[model samples]
Target: MAAQPGGRRGPARGPSKGAAGGQARGQVRRSWLGGVRDAIDGLVRSSPARFAILVFATLVLITTALLSLPLARAGAGTGGTPLYDAFFTAVSTICVTGLTTVDMATHWSPFGNTIIFIGMNVGGMGVLTLASILGLVISRRLGLRAKLMAASDTNPSRVHAGPVSERQAVRLGEVGGLLVTVAVSTLSIEAVIMLGMVPSVMAKGHDFGLSLWYSAYYAVSAFTNTGFNPNPLGPAEFFDDYWFQSLMMLAVFLGSLGFPVIFALLRTWRSPRRWSVHVKLTLTTTIVLWIAGAMTFLVLEYNNPKTYGSFGFVKTFYEAFFMSTMTRSGGFSTIDMADLYGSSLLVTDMLMFVGGGSASTAGGIKVTTLAVLFLAAYAEARGAPAMEAFGRRIPRDILRLAVSVVLWGATIVAVSTVIIAQITKSALDFVLFDVISAFATCGLSTGLTESLPPEGKYVMAATMFMGRVGTVTLAAALAAAQKRQLFRRPEERPIVG
Candidate 1:
């Protein structure tokens, strides 16, 4: 240290100017961090899409973990299948697909059933939206990415363009409130249905405890568009019970109608003349689809012995209604889906392909997308300048998105069907039905699920996940990797038929 350098006395004694400079830099970093903290505090808010995805993923993980537990296995009484079965079941539930390897009634314990019920609810409400609410409640700060993601997920056109800070805050509040209201209403309706069914279930010779369990399980399942049933006896036991079936159908239909329709109804209740155009369109499309689907199925299967089975006209009508309702995203089946004639199967496949409405627990290409695509096509056919529906002009971008979503969804199902056929050597009809069911998160099976190999099951699992998360989401994520400059190039024409 005697001749270290001509620096400060303290630095010359032990260190040099470099050490003091490093200390100063550390202090500056601390100060900078403090400023960053302040900036973050100002920008803190919830992100609905991120929240929904995170929650969905977390629930899937938790469900898997619970199913893997020793207690859960013991309750099943045969080692409860393998890790993959549980993992797939968890994913299916979180995705709101009712497909299952093991029957819920015969295999899972009450606790396990409860977990499934929760999964359905979580999936129905949307995991990302739920998670965003949680983050808002906890820290009152949602990242910008979360907000942008939420906007993308929920349709950014709906987002208001106010002051940046104000708009985000408003959106958070509105979405949070809307989600809570929908969830509450859904649970309430399910509770009422459960209570109503308890008596019917008891009358069918089920014990009080069993009846209660079955009623609750069915209620949750129906209300979330999850086709899982707590009764091992299957739909046969309830086939003759008109009231029970009706209640189940109602719950399923209501659940599959999508949250936007529900919100529209609520808004109408509050102010009849104030219903938004989206609400009006959603209700009209939903009602029309319901009628069309029900009528088609009724006509197609009215005389089919496998479907109607010589039941009275009333029962036949009820079963047709049930099938129509269930096929639009609900997985419940009053008759054996495998026994349907080729025509009936084709009708069902079409219904499942169109799916339920947007922003609903139900899946498929989404009724709104189908509706928009049809409108756009019709306009083009008529040589009209704009796409119109419910007396309002539908934006070109929205129409394009709808078309994209449908094409992507159809492609996914087609590819998945081919892959499943290769793996299982199943007939094309059954394999296609299974693929569509999984892709739509409809949960209905043509008995192929039990016969599927591990690879087949995996394929179905992937389809279910994609169906629930949305083909558009997956497509966007893939496209994001190839992002380029916003500058547009000159348009070029391509040959077409």
Candidate 2:
């Protein structure tokens, strides 16, 4: 040892060099991690859409990896699940889009099924919403940016430039309560649905334990609008079980209504006048679509012989109603979708394309979007300057956003259908049906999904991802990439359609 500057004696030189080197490495690692954390936080604060997409994509990747494991597959020594199937299933599960390339009942092990169950619940909770909830739990409160993001989950327009109106589906100050509502509502609703279905499942010849498992699976699937069946026979086993079908329909309807609407209804149940315009529009439009779709189905398929024709009037009506409900992102079916008339398929396509409510587990352009567009058309025909719904004049910007969402959704569906159609060369009708199903995340299929080529599956998987992440959110994320201008270009009318 030797004397060192400002020290009595030198620490052993060899040990000192190693310790200094270790300290430098640790500092570098800490700095790197800190940089990564800052980047993530910056993303979360800057654009909630991109952050939500990143989180969802990461979740899908993790789910895919789990499903790829050998243990995730059924049958001893069957080897690891195929990448295409695992990846597709991962997207389907995490998106709560139940389209599957493989048989749900025979393909996955218990571990795999558990992963799907958990993933569906997580995915059913909107991505931005889950992130905000986690942030609130970790930090004991949400920051301004976190609240803004959560508000965006409830109202996509909240993230737009300019001050948001106090009138919102879920306001900034109420974001914390909204997050709590999301968690509490999801768990409570699912539990109730699960309990309700257990006895019906037990009556279907299963023991209490098996019935409980099936009931729990169906509860999560139904509420999430996931459409997965644990049984070998699928929905066919319950085609005549009115109680099971009714409960399932109830769960699907509630789940499709979106959390904000649920929050609104719960808060304003006593006073109908206190209900927000969004609540009014979503409920009215959804009910109208449900009934209209049922009638259309009954008309189109009543004489098809293979479908509704075999059943009597009551059975036909019930089945028509069930199918109509399922088409709105519910994904369950009691009969073969391929057996429907072409006209019925076209009608189903229209219904599924409209999908459920905004910020809900179900996807598509969203019911609010359809309502806004329809109102816009109605107002235009009346030569009105603004769209009005439930006595509230909808702003032009909201109309613009609604149009953008529908256009974006239609474009995505068209592109996906063409790509998948080119890949498989299947009949155009079935191909279109399944493509719309994937794009809407509605999960209905005309036997096209299971038989799609690998490339087609990939396209459908991407479609499902886009549909679940939302057209509006994706558009917002894209728009956020551009720098904001201090001035606007002069508006000009181009041409009439």
Candidate 3:
């Protein structure tokens, strides 16, 4: 009608503000997405180390949010978890570190526990390795770059600027197999362990349904080296359950061996000579530490009535061995850590500091680092030009990397320990023990973690984050912050003690 009135001309129209606004919004959205895609590509291509740290940090944030929900607290829908407790628990869970600022068994609802269970499993899988596996699942094939990124998890040098040597624990060609191995081994090991613990859990007066749940939880916790106890009595309920204890110890040993070592062992079980240097060193060093730690604990705690004094010879040996396994980042503890002799605590600190194998679920500087340092010392004692192990020579770069990891880990622990001690004014023994436990991702505590002030808890959470992300990975990320230099500086030897 209006058009007809205007003689075939429409009435004057308004500016197409809605259309223009929509178009502008679309452009902005596209630009933001494009920027994100480009950044992700750069991250995946140039530095998987950075990508890994980013992933863990993201998971921490997400888990924190989930744990902070009102439903996450036990017996309460109205009262939400404290941000401090939620954040600390989130860090500990995602890091697969067992240190907690709250009561794990009684404090959280089933929803919170489920979140923790999922977080530990995801965190236990190496970050870069998980990315590669996801890539494979999505595309049905892993690209060369993806393989390189996955390899970097097993061997940090893959992310550094240099030609990758053929003498690797996992060759580039075998990366696809390694990915399969990681997924399969994690599932199979946890499943088998879960089934084995069902009987023991049932013996504890839990119904079949409850037993299954507890069994599965313990299996995951043990395999992930996360010592979170779902039972109200803690490990004390299962203290005398030999079958459960043995299975837990076995699971922890296997977990601490690292996925690369596990893969290698699976392939070369029948031929030890064919095992990679990494596998050999990890196994040998792990065995040595296990035995030595047990003996040290047995000797130191045998007379302490507060600890092993009440136990007979066999029980004392068993508990000592169990604690030794836990110190290798297993985190499970049946006795009061405060009752341990100071000397025993120092030994635990050392073992925890050494932690587990490279790329393992356990934390600390890693068993491989300890192995490498020892190998280097032995070589130096013999005046060899390079560190040698299992008939293979380790590169100087690896040795330097080991030193860097140790230094980085020690610095983190030292700084956190000082800050926490200052905050709580606690005894150095207890402070140092919990700090190392946090740094090693070992859950053993002198009851110090829960008593710490909020500031101290925050410090411990940061320590757990750094520990689980790994000192080696952190060093690699920091190294990647600067481009590789084309020029070299003159070398000078400095005298040292």
Candidate 4:
């Protein structure tokens, strides 16, 4: 092609046209590079909440990919599990739910177990939060997006107030301190339990090395609220050991209570009279729930032959405590859950639905949200203008958010349970339990997970993700589509019972 400008020879015009074409290509290349640079900058400076969600999604994807690999599946027993099982397992791990489609001990090799353990750690701590923490440790400065992401992960509403520089720093410090404390406490307790379990495990004629491995695996698994057992050995063999069961129960209990609650207790311990309202409420609710659940389990299963199964009164109480605590989120089982009677199953479902505390590894709607809702209801009942708990008035916005979260969570669980039941043709109780287990990220099941159809598996996977990130967080991310308007619609009253 020739340029059609000015008075110029055709031959001269041809060179000019070529020069223009070269310049145009150069401009296009520069524009493409500029676009790429802008994208990188945008990603780096993206909203922390968005960044966190992205990171979490990426981690889950990576986990799913790894679990799908033939090499990863190698030696995981009987060659490899179904792709659905692997995917479900990966989702369960990333969601920090202990539910398993396959018996972990008989199926996975040591490497697979390690992958699971790491996934547990990452899941327990928010993936983005952990990444941000690591970045802070190495760089000593958080990017703008990292700070915002930290705030969102810890408390999303706080991000709306302003730039969360100081708050992010404080929250990050708290998280780091909490992790260190949990690690130390978990290791110490596990070490003691390992020592205790060694004798018992060795007594069963297992080799010392294998016994040690089992002890370590159980220790980490229990504390992480991961119900995985490295040994295919059933609970029947260890059921009679009171001390072992008690030790495991304690680990599960501590693990179920979120790290923030633990840290709050520790801080209160340092100054007995000056506990924060949050600390007091969390401790009180936790203690009350534990005692009430244990008692309820014992009373409900007292005459039932399946669960108590001809045990003495003392043994009954011990088993009851284990069941209650495990149902809270631990997923560990000293008894076959399938053996539990109808009443006992209902009680366990209630416990699983209530779940553990906020900002912790444990899921469910969260104790804090529950507390807030109850307090809000009480305030309305008493004709009070504001919601108060433990002498502190919870902000109306927070209360609204809490209620929304609980409702949304319940709805998700309910819908998913229906879908799962339809897909699997399982009994309502077992399917509901599985749905609750996924929603609470608790992982306990009545052996229904493996039997679930692929559709049911997908439902559980979605439930697990929602439980981990939380309904409110997901809602907020999705709610960004709603634009702000200068004018508000008039409030209207609706008829009600």
Candidate 5:
């Protein structure tokens, strides 16, 4: 234990040149890593929208890899899931689209199912929502741009709601509270629903483990409005249980309302007057659509024996309501979708087209977009220059955005239908329904999903990704690097009806 270096006993050298050189190289390596990390962080901050899309894409790729693992599957016909099937399922689950090429319970091992569960949770909760939450947990701090990115990505209606999450993130306002509220509110709602669901699931399964798993799975799925039926029998098995159906209905309804509404309601339960106009419009419109869609289904499918002829009036009513509830991005079906009267399919298709609210796990052009467009039309008909809603004047930019989203959505649905129509040669009605479902991120199907060719599956998979990230967001990510125009051409109006 002699002293080192310049100590009298050893008179050791300060350092060897080789050791010094190695230390210098290690420092250089560390510096290089730090530079790479900083560059990535800078890129993400500058283009938060693109970064968010990239993050979701990366997550989808990870999910695809995990699901394709041989260990992730049960010993079925093949040792592992096929590449196409795995890719399709990964996109579906991570997008919370719920479209499945294979049966969930029968085809997937426990590990595979868990992977799906985790992916749905991550996807169902906005990707940026999870990212910001993780950042908060790890560093106890987050950037303004990061919060603004989450706000825009989740709530398209708030795309121009500048610095809402940012300012709030600094002062522990709604956006700041959102980081915790997202996780708490989600689990809280799911837990209550799960608890209520257990006895019913248990009665049906007669095994505690089976019931618990089903309860937890359904709680997560329903609250996310993903409508995944892990039940081997499919969701139809619970059709007779009034209590189970009621709980599910509530979960799907609330989940589709989106986090902003949920948080507002939770924060100011008694102050309905203080609720944001977004929440007010969303609730009113949702209730109206639900009732309207339910009545249409009840009238058209009431006597269709395959769908609801045997059910009593009350049961039929439940099924009708459930059907309508599901079409708003919840994919569960109490009866076969194909057996529904053609008129009912049309109704469901329209409902899917006008999906749930912005910032919700639900997808489509979004309820707000439709409401804005219709409101603008009404105002224009009356000769009012501007659209008004809930005593707030709608901005012109928002109108432009709404129009863009609707047109973009319509174009996608039309193109997708044409492509799949040729590939499957399925009936136009069925093809249109499935195409809209894929684009809306609504997992409803016409029994044609499994039969689609590889080409068609890939088409649907890409559509699902676009729907989840938003067509506009995808377009933005790709075009964001372009320089903004500093001048504009003279305006001109084209003739219209």
Candidate 6:
């Protein structure tokens, strides 16, 4: 959930710099574990998507094992950590879905919290993506077969085996180096956000160490969109300060924009035109949703005393904006969602279903999916031959993929809602919100999470796991080995939607 080299034939080479950390370079031989890892590596190189799913399953198992330990659970609640509870918590945290059966602050020890932190940090990107990035960083290369499987060069690729041109070497370097920049950028932003949020804790008179820990935990959580607040007292404690609120909002905003967008923008700081079309579509859709969702919340919750009504205009506006931002898989809420108006809940459900951008810490159908769906509709209505957005033509195959993702996501959410409603005896709307939150990996709950039964919790864990891995990825895995058709079938017109 992890870094550099120095080379050769220089000066008097004082005992060699690579060995300066006390361990000799290449002193340790590969273990039996490395053989197991190599087998897994070969599997990953063979089928990145399928292997990525396997890796996530394996991580969840590892996380569950750690959580089931006696110390991972508190000595307080329910006497002992139930296997289901530990398993559910592991899934939620590893999926970066904040649904929890026990109160995180009360139930988990520092060791447990650290485990959750590691999970969120690694799970911010899909497991396969993380593995690919790590493979590049540690090995300084990715397999050529893996490269061809990738939809973007941002996904790592292997260095060629034979003689290479200078320009090709530079390109290869950038491909591998992108992972480093992504890692560095994530840590740096989180650090700044932690600092920005620190003074708020100090103002509350919390001890320095506790404040630092809280600040760090939340910075990681917020940026990863896990939204698992570590404070025992909840938002009423340290987060009462407006400055901290703004910083947290900004952190969530950046995190949900997707890593590739951030990397491109960071690397090419000033050039708007140089940004990729994917980046442009993501940013534009994100911005539009943020503003529109904020406005919708303000309009709907304006008079609801339980939410923004009591705060008055200026404060309410900010709160609304924050809530709206949080809705795009931000997962944190300043007000009681249970108390919000039905209309507000409906709006929130929609936003949670929409989720954040692709390749982001956020979940849901993804803003790009929505953009593609809408653009395809526009193209169809105009009788145009292609779907175009921001002057780039979107392939018909992409449109089909987008529709499949949305439909699959919606189907999962709908089924889960019914199951949860039956188990929890919650109303349909409330259950729908919870289910959609789980499905989108948004983690926002309407006070129903903790009240759900063990079975209910398991249902959510399954939904979160699938959502985090992606409905499309899961569907593809399940529908493995697409058989090639030997003969073309006749096309038939079907009834319209």
Clashes of each: 9, 0, 0, 2, 0, 0
TM-score of each: 0.84, 0.92, 0.91, 0.83, 0.91, 0.87
True-vs-predicted CA distance for residue 472, candidate 6, Å? 1.5
Residue 308 lDDT in candidate 1? 83
What are the candidates' C-alpha RMSDs? Answer: 7.3, 4.3, 5.6, 7.8, 3.9, 9.3
Clashing pairs for model 2 are none
Candidate 3 matches the true fold with a TM-score of 0.91
Model 2 C-alpha RMSD to native: 4.3
lDDT of 1 by residue, 1-497 (tens): 56546555544375457987998899999889767655434432332333344456677888999986656653534665577788889988888889988777767766677788888887887544555455445446555444443434344333212123211112433555565666688789889999999999999999999899889888888888888887877766888888998898888878876665676576566774566555656567778888888888878777888778687887777777788889988898877889998888888898888887666778898777777777887998999999886566776867766777878888898899889998988899999998898998998899998678777777888888878877665554344233358899999999977
Judged by whole-model lDDT over C-alpha atoms, candidate 3 comes out at 0.86
Question: What TM-score would you give candidate 1 relative to the actual structure?
Answer: 0.84
What order do you get sorting by lDDT, best first?
2, 3, 5, 6, 1, 4
**lDDT computed for candidate 5:** 0.81
Which candidate achieves the best lDDT against the true structure? 2
lDDT of 6 by residue, 1-497 (tens): 11013334344466656566445424333445467667767765555667667868888999999988877776645344788888988888888888778888878887788899888888886554675665555445566543332223222111111222211112433544555655787899899999987889878888999889989988988888888989877665744588888888888898888776787788776988777667888889999999999999989888887877777698878888999999998888877789988888999999999988776788898898899899988998999999887677776766777888889998998888888888888788889988898988888888898887788888989999988888766765565555568999899999977
lDDT of each: 0.74, 0.88, 0.86, 0.72, 0.81, 0.77
* Model 4, position 242: C-alpha lDDT score: 73
Better of 1 and 3 by lDDT: 3
Residue 371 local lDDT, model 2? 92
lDDT of 4 by residue, 172-200 (tens): 44555654665566567667777877777
Pick by TM-score: which candidate is best? 2
Off by over 4 Å in 6: 1-38, 75-80, 134-140, 148-174, 238-240
Model 5 residue 367 lDDT score:
86
